[model samples]
Target: MTIFRLPTAPRSLQKDQPIKFILDSEAIDCLAHNIALVHPVFDVQAFRQLALTDIAALGFMDRSAHIAAALKATLPAKFADATEVLINTLTPPNAHTERLGLGVFFYLPHTRFVAEYGRDHKHNAGEDPFDAAMRAQYELTRRFTAEFSIRPFLMHDFERTLKQLMQWLDDPDPHVRRLCSEGTRSRLPWGARIPQLIKDPTPTLPILDALKSDPSLYVRRSVANHVGDIAKDHPELAFDLCDRWLSHADKELKWVIRHAVRHPARQGNATAIALRKAAGGR
Candidate 1:
């Protein structure tokens, strides 16, 4: 595994005395392995929070993908310790879904990782870290690939994965269906910019079309974001998407459009400005 090290001190740490942070054995092992080459001093708790926050911040850059890959590689293969740590870290207030968003950011490269660790019928659902890992893995992996990676492959042999993801859109589980949209978002946080779709986003039309009216607000938000991404590139399309579905969209979808178009709107992008105006400041 590549060694990832951070600078011996961050700006904050360098200014203050070194604050000792203790980590449990599993987290310690994971951090040591992952950070061995990375160089930053990690206070166990701080590092974990950093990981979660970084995961949520994926849309900004490719940094989270590096963290996710390093995180998986560094963790002890045995789940006994890691599972407890991960579960304990879960707090509703923290927005576990944001951590899940990291999955989309790191999805394409982690395909192999997910196939190796994702749910297996053989594994029973329980305290098993493997199962939790699998569920978490799929939540991040499948969704991201379905949402983002789907477009890249459409022009070539990628259709297979795309079709498979579409099938997952109809999954019995709401999480899986949500993945179908969230995974494919063009402007998803911490993910790559979908230039092709950005220029002409017809590729994602079907996926967004399928998810536009999904029962889960979770799934629908992604669809809105996916369309909003396209809108940045082609505002007319975004306008059409919103105009066609305005009645069906809830507040979440509107929020996504506002966020995704913020930059373009600021840049005086006529399309986004028009959509912004049409939306009537809601």
Candidate 2:
């Protein structure tokens, strides 16, 4: 394994603080070491070389994917087995999913691993790739947001994937429920846009409608974001949905509807403004 000495913060900051921003060499060492512990045959030294080489040039997410590529090289070619190793390495999640600390960033590369390689199309494992990928993502989201990773699967088999998402609307974990909306977002920032959804975002409405009244504010916030994404391309659909949500709008639903229409209301869409007002917004 690489001897990862912490990168010293430039002389500008406090002397004792090391720059621990993105996945630095130390992060890779730690991640690789964890994987080694779970999968005994994992070549930790090789992963170090692959993940650390040229890592300085990459940005946050690129660094994540670079490390994932390294894992893809070292781990078992069987997708299910590889993801299982990652699942074993997760720090057990607690009751609260919303305000977890920065430590969740440790799994960023794990999400990337599932995103890039989850769809094992030419499967030698005799199991559906979608099943493996979604299962992995369901686990991954509890540890770290799997919103980005789920996009590829959504694009691969829209209907098949969406069926599962619909079922997840009532998930016990807020993260899983949130993923039902967030993962299907039409224009999720930094996520692959689902063009079909953008053209007719109506498909996502049921998921939002199910979640608009979610107990967790964490889940409700994502519902708002998903609705906002709808508003961007198809304002009519969004306005209509907000209008319906207004029928029994409580404080939480009102907040979600207001946020869902915020941008459009600002852009002077009369319908959005009307919906916002109806939802008791300013």
Clashes of each: 18, 0
Candidate 2 positional error at 179, Å: 0.2
TM-score of model 1 (CA atoms): 0.48
List per-prediction Cα lDDT, in the order shown. 0.48, 0.82
Per-residue CA lDDT of candidate 2, range 5-124, in tens?
222224333346433454787778788777777788999899899988888878878888999999888888788888888877776655686556556676788899888887766532
The candidate that wins on TM-score is 2
Deviation from native of the Cα of residue 164 in model 2, angstroms: 1.4
Model 2, global lDDT:
0.82
Which residue segments of model 2 deviate by more than 4 Å? 1-20, 123-127
Q: In model 2, which residue pairs have backbone atoms overlapping below 3 Å?
A: none
Tens digits of lDDT, candidate 1, 2-72 = 53321232223233432221112233345444443343332445446545443433432244244434445
Q: Model 1, residue 60: displacement in angstroms? A: 14
